[model samples]
Target chain A: DVKVTQSSRYLVKRTGEKVFLECVQDMDHENMFWYRQDPGLGLRLIYFSYDVKMKEKGDIPEGYSVSREKKERFSLILESASTNQTSMYLCASSSTPVTNYGYTFGSGTRLTVV
Target chain B: EDQVTQSPEALRLQEGESSSLNCSYTVSGLRGLFWYRQDPGKGPEFLFTLYSAGEEKEKERLKATLTKKESFLHITAPKPEDSATYLCAVHSFSGGYNKLIFGAGTRLAVHP
Candidate 1:
C-alpha cells in the first residue's frame, strides 16, 4: 500500500518562530502538495512541487513556503508562525494530476501557534 | 474560475437511514469529480471518482453519480461507523495545469 508519513501528528510553536512540517511518500510520486484545513473554509492549497527542487504557489501561499529536495520528501515551512496560522496541515502525493489517479494523504499534523 | 459547492453543511441520520449529498461545480472543462471521507483529526481518504456525466460507481453501501454540472454521493443504510465529513472536489484545467477546487464539505452524523 502507498504510505505518506508525516513527521509529527501534532506540533506547537510560538509566534514569530519558524516551523517545519515534514512529509515523505514511499511511492516515488512526481507530485506533492501541502494544504491547510480550516473549518468552514475547507482545504486550501498552500504550495505544491511537481519535481525535485521545483515548486508552484497555490491560492494561499502568502504565509508559507515549501521545499522539495528529493523525490520522496516534501517539506512545508512557516517563515514566521502566527496565531492565525494554527490549523491542520496535510500532505499528499500523486503520480499525476490528483483528479486522474487520486491522491494518497498523510495522517496530517495539527499545528498550534501561540 | 473553477468552483465547487457542497450543500446542507451538516446532516444527522438514524441507523439504516439513507440519504444523498450534493456537489455542484462550475469550471471551464470538467476533467474529474472526486468524493472523499474524512474522520476527525485525519486526512481525507479517497472514495470515488466520476469522469463524466451519466457515469456511476459503487462501493459497498456508497454510490456516486455525476451529471453535467453536479455529482451526488448516495449513502444507503448508513451506520454509526459511516459518520464522517464527506468532501467533494473538481479537477479542471487551469493556468496550464489541472488544479483541484474543493467544497466546504458535508458533515454527516449517524445515530444508533
Candidate 2:
C-alpha cells in the first residue's frame, strides 16, 4: 500500500510567523502536491512539484512556496502566516500523470493562525 | 476553462436506502475521472477511476459509472458507516502536470 505522511496533524501559529508543512511519500512517486481545504471551497491547489528541484504554481499559490529537494519529501512554506491562511493542508503523491490512477493523500494538517 | 460540478450538496438516507451522486464536468480533453471518499478531518481516500465514457467500476456496495459529460456514483443498501463526503475530480489532458479540478463534494449521511 502507498503511504503519504504529513509531519503535523494540527498546528497553531501567530499572525506573522513562518510555518512549514512537511510531507513524505513512501511509494517513490514523481509528482507531489499541496492543497488547502476551506469550508465551502473544496480543495484548492497551492503548489506542486513534478520532480526534484521542479515546482509549479496552482490555482491559489499566493503567500505560499514549495521545496522538493528530494524525491520522497515535499515541503510547503508559508512566507508570512496570516489568519486567511489558516485551513486544513493536504499532501498527495502520484506515480505519473499518464495513468488513470488518482493520487494518494496524507491525513492532512489543520493549521490555525491567530 | 475546465470545470467540475457536483449536485445535491448533501443527502440523507435510511440505513438500507440506496441513492446516486452526480458529478458533471467540462474540459477540453478528458484524461480520467476519479471518485473519492473523505471522512471528517481526513484526506480523501481514492475509490474509483473511470477512463472512458462507457466504463464502470465497482467495489463492495459502491458502483461508479461514467458518461461523456458526467459520472455517477451509486450506493446500494448503505449503512451508517457508509456516511462520508464523496468527492469527484477530473484530470484534463490540456493542463500541465495532470492537474485535477475538483468539485465541492456531496456529503452523505446514513442513519439507522
Candidate 3:
C-alpha cells in the first residue's frame, strides 16, 4: 500500500503566526495536493504540484502556498494564519493524471488558529 | 459551473438496514466520479471510481452505480462498522489541469 505521511496530527497556532504542514509520499507519485476541509464547505483545494519545483494554485489559494523541493515531499505554508483558517488539512498523492487512479490520502492534520 | 452535491446531510440506520446515498454533479466534462469513506478526524479513504453511465462496482456490502448526472452508493445489510462519512467527488478540466471537486459528504451512523 502507498503511504502518505503527514508531519502533524494536531496543531494550534496564534493568529498571524506562520505555520507549515508537511507531507511525504513513499510511492514516488508525481502529483501531490493540499486541501482544506471545512464544515458545510467541504474540501477545497489549496495547492497542488505535479512535479518537483512545480506548483499550481487551486480554488482557494489566497492564504496558502506550497513548495515541492523534492519529489517525495510537499509542504503547505500558511504565511499568516488566521482564525478563519482553522480547518482540517489533507495531503494526497497520485501518479500523472488523477483520473488514472484516485489519490492516496494521508491521515490529515487538524490545525486550529486562535 | 462544475459542482458536486450529496443528498441527506446525515443518516442513522440500525444494523442490517439498507439504504442508498446519492451524488449529483454538473460539470463541463465528466472524466470520472469517485466514492470515499472517511472516519471522524481522518482523511478520506478511496472506495470506487466510475467512468461512464450505467457502470457499477461493488465491495463487501456496498455497491456504487453511476449515471450521466448522478451516482448511487447502495449499502446492503450494513453493520456498525459501516458507519462513516461517505464523500463524492468529480474530476473536470480546470486551471490547466484536471480539478477534483468534492461534496460536503453524508454522515452515516449505524447502531448495532
- Predictions' DockQ, in order: 0.71, 0.71, 0.76
Compare the candidates by DockQ and give the number of the best one: 3
Instruction: Encode model 1's per-residue lDDT on B17-65: one tens digit a residue.
Output: 9999999999887888999999998999999999989999999989999
Please provide TM-scores, in order, for all candidate models, with all chains considered together: 0.98, 0.97, 0.98
**Candidate 2's residue-wise lDDT over A5-47, tens digit each?**
9999999999989999999999989999999988767888899
**Model 3: per-residue Cα lDDT over A79-114, one tens digit each:** 999999999999999987684557889999999999
Cα distance off (Å), candidate 3, residue B11 = 0.5
Predicted chain A of model 3: TM-score relative to the true chain A? 0.97
Candidate 1 CAPRI level: medium
Worst 10 residues of 3 chain A by lDDT: A95-104
Screening candidate 2 with a backbone cut-off below 3 angstroms (N, C-alpha, C), the clashing residue pairs are none
Candidate 1 share of real interface contacts: 0.60
- Please provide, for model 3 over B3-64, each residue's C-alpha lDDT reduced to its tens digit, 9 standing for 90 to 100: 99998889999999999999999987799999999999898999999999999999999999
lDDT of 2 at A60: 94
Candidates in descending DockQ order: 3, 1, 2
DockQ: which is higher, 1 or 2? 1
Which structure is stronger by TM-score: 2 or 3? Answer: 3
- If you score just chain A, what TM-score does every candidate get? 0.97, 0.97, 0.97
